[model samples]
Target: GAGLGDHIDRKEGQEHTFQNADPARRQLNQSFAVTDHCSKPLHTAISDRIAEGYTGTTAIRKDAVRALSLVFTGTHEDMKAIEADPEKLQGWLKANYQFVTQEFGKENVVRLALHLDEKTPHLHAVVVPLVEGKLTAKKLLGNRKDMSERQDRYAKAMEPFGLSRGVRGSKAVHNSEGWYLGQQQQAQKAVLSDLPKLTALDRINPARYEEKVQERFKFVSREKTDTAIELKRRTDQVRHAQASQHKAEQEAARHREATQSIAAQLLQAGKAGITLDSSYALLKAPAAIREAANTLFQEEVRKLADTHLKQGAEAYYRGIYQLEDSSKATREDYERHQKHDSEETRNHIAGEITRIFNQEIQQRWGVELSPEASLYKELRKKAADLVRELAKTILQELRKALGLEEPRQQRKSRGLGR
Candidate 1:
């Protein structure tokens, strides 16, 4: 609540420091208690109401959420229309307050205030989220689905003022297609309003009325056709997005298969490609033979890098499965694990790769250990990858023959696995 009270300061008739607030218009703002319990000086009033309603056995924490402050308003243009007309302004205020009270019981409502001092006139309502005598914001505010339902309810309540629910991230001009349906609804309602009067013969002459209705009916028909087209276009966009996702997933699978195939080729190449001598022989070899030796070494390092990357992916899934098995996994937990574990895995593999590469560089190049040379930094970084595949394979085979190792289960993915 530290920064939450700035917009609400004007509601309590406090001196507003915000540039957008108008001091002169401050007198025009009106605040009302839903049941005459929570009065002016809104904070104290709200605290008292919560003290009365909260039925938790233990003392409430100072940081516990006691209320939900909802600001009800429309787009700039929508509010502009309501502000220009005194009647609609009051009607909207009444409608918003009623909707709030209905949704959160009147007993829970602390204060409803209309602020006329802002650029766009809006109503801010504070309601204590005391559900069955317990203060639980989750029970009252719920999740996104519940908030969406609230938007539908609020939009319907504001329909009489010709305002529709706005698209979440779209501008009014871009929302024209959705607005088309709202226009058709308004026109249809106008015609419906005229029908009962026409039945009594007290309305305008039947001929003119019929003509007016016919034109409106034509407009509604055209709008309906446009709305249908818009719906189809949006549906197609969703399908296109889903299809693109599926295609990307297939591409990834193919990439993994290609990598495995290439790794096998590299392993085979390492076994049969080139045999090297001491540094003396290597230095004496022709440039062509030296180039082949370099290529062979590079392939071996790459094979290790690719293998470590695969293992890291398997380790990530293993962690996710462990969390899921604990039954307390959350999206935030998964994201945090990915962020921290990725950096750690990269560093660990890089160190192992650098260590093995350096040992080979010293032995094969006939150079004494000068591991800290600035020359090795770039070389270490360039070759930093995984491990020596040939040695790893030989050791694994030895362990299998001696019954010192068991076959590992298939590489795991997210969720539960034996």
Candidate 2:
């Protein structure tokens, strides 16, 4: 029996942290307990381990939790498998212990106890926050983000044991086994709170109340159907929008290719004029011919640069629209499957795409542009590089056609434009 001042809800025959507490429970013989700090009972060992670490901090936080006690169990059906096979139960217990030991370093895991006496097998573990030889509960398990990650990691670790993590951000709240049972009883009572009066007139006139309830139910069903239809209609609209967006993107790409072709033609003309001038200079032609050739070459180079910039800007905008469509498609696919993508996954993919896009833009234009850039600058530097390469090839072919000795000065300034 519980003594004075003890919790009234503390039911009898409940298992405690102490070993060999239940005499009638035959499965207690199979129960196992372990601790790294001491051979003492589970509760005492956990307390001592935390107290020892507390010496490192001069000012202890009042709201801090020195140790975290976690209970690991499975659904009733999963438990049934363990009940049918003792080996299966032991395997589960070992997996839980291993997870605790690995997560919080083996030295920081104070105690692990498997309770076989309970109807459902569960392992209770006490982990002290002792990272870098200091007591820091906040560093261990203080925030919701860390807690969510812990759940994910635990679920992955328990995957081989056939356990799953609960839905993230669910409405269901955690409570002790006793508290759950009490809540269940309270809910059963609450279900009848709106019962009609049991008068003789009411008993004979229950049809009126039944009709009202039926009408309310019919209204709810109609609303549900309307909402579902609206959702389907919206889905179709998005698909149509995506198709139109893709078509627009293809047309924009063709326009950009045409613009780039114009730029290439201008670059080729400039290279040809420069090659002709160099040949004339080697053949000792008049200064008038060389000067005219230089002017034409400069004009062609300027025109080529302008066209290239226009082409790159157009291409950048095209990429932006295509990327937007891709993102919409990703979101629509998730909606179609009715599977919610975690914000973390979505953000990670978005970040990766943004990084790759920025790198491509920087390489193509020699300048990093913002994601929402309305105007892209001229890629004169890249255009010049392309023109220089083509000029080298043209220069080599012209030198072969003229059969003239290459001038020493020309050879010295051979790769100057590049």
Candidate 3:
């Protein structure tokens, strides 16, 4: 970005400096040399070097590069370490200056400066492309192989200072921030566009509409599996990201298992080849169905949540404490996980609830409950709400399902009788 300038009227205490550092930081920048010969300004010195190097010929082209600019620094941490120690910093500067002077012959290095006020301390050098007493930029610039060997030489020189070559910029990154969200929306809209047109009848019947949507659009998108899974579990992104890798993987695995199990339930129902004309509401159903649901829920679902899921949540935190060292961040994370129903546990609970409801419908009434059915929606809502209530209001030791505390005190304060 530096332009060609043969003259510059520099302010006081800022001569022979090429760095465009902040005016406030100019005091922190050090100019080591500008031509081993005369004490001239930076631009004047640069022009003089190019003129002196040209041996033969016609006027020089205006666009010709007079010198190559080189910048060298190690990793940020390494540079900071050298800066902290005066001995090491001086040695590093010496090593770099020697490398530049040796590489371009002491006479051709027009200007050298060390910048220390920036986040990374680095050396900048300007070298005239003078070879065999003639201006030959190509000879000094060299082919790829020659340039690589030149890099190796510099690395060898800085070896004692623990400086090494930065990683090569060969990979082209294609995506920017929010690229995932854009891609997800595009994929979702593309997939959902292909559904068959709903009839007036279908519009009236949400069950038929929902079943058609489910049957036609099985995947969020088929182009990428990871993206598909991510879109399917979109609500879980923030929780998944802050959680440990092990916890995140557990959630993904549990999700896949629950989905597969629900698919198998549908398949089993289809294979039986029995169908009922309509559905029954679990609460407002015949006395027989209502009584059966409450009794079956007690036996099949509630017991599982009270024992296995609760203990599993507690055991999970216990294992977390054993494996992970104590830290303010980790402890905070553990406490948050305890407070919420973890996605993995949530998925398992939903799957079990769905399984029991499906079994109840198919076995007792020969009906397969579509998600749009009033009975299916009500039962699922009631079951999930029950779990939430227990976790929040907390009944007796059932408070432990959510890692709740102060049950007796809480109860008395809330006016629950003894």
Ranking by TM-score: 2, 1, 3
lDDT of 1: 0.62
* Tens digits of lDDT, candidate 3, 1-418: 1232211222455432323335576566666754563245556666787777677677777787667666777656889999889999989889888888887888887667777765567776777778886677888778877877887888888888887642233232323213643674577577677766777776788776766674345343533634554444443434444554777788678666655754554566567653322333244344444455556644554454445544444343334334232232344444554566565655455555565656755664445657786656655665565445433432233334435455577679888757
Candidate 2, residue 33: lDDT: 40
**Model 3 weakest 10-residue run by lDDT:** 1-10
- Tens-place lDDT per residue, model 2, 1-418, is 1210011112244422122234465445232344555345445655677676556647656676666656777765676677568787677777777778777877776556555555455665667787775677778775988888988999987787677776676544555544543543454345445545556766666778766654455444444544654465456556666876999999778666655754564577676553433434323334444455446644543464456543543344225333223223443332332242244433443444444444654564344545454322123334334333433443344444445456677777876423
- Residue 260 of model 3, lDDT score: 71
lDDT string, candidate 1, 1-418, tens digits: 3233444655344332233467888788787767665564556656777888888899888888777777777655778899899998989888987898888889988777788887677787778888898888889887978877887888899899998764543322443423644665576566556654457554648878876766656555555655665576566557666876999999778666655754564566568664345442335344444455556755654565455544543343344434423234455544454454454555555555556555655564554334685545644554333323322333344444444533445223323255
Badly placed stretches (over 4 Å) of model 1 are 1-17, 168-418
lDDT of 2 at 285: 34
TM-score of each: 0.39, 0.40, 0.37
How far is 275's C-alpha from truth in model 2 (Å)? 47
**Candidate 2 weakest lDDT stretch, 10 residues:** 1-10
Which ranges in model 2 have alpha carbons more than 4 Å from their true place? Answer: 1-26, 29-33, 36-38, 55-63, 176-418
TM-score of 3: 0.37
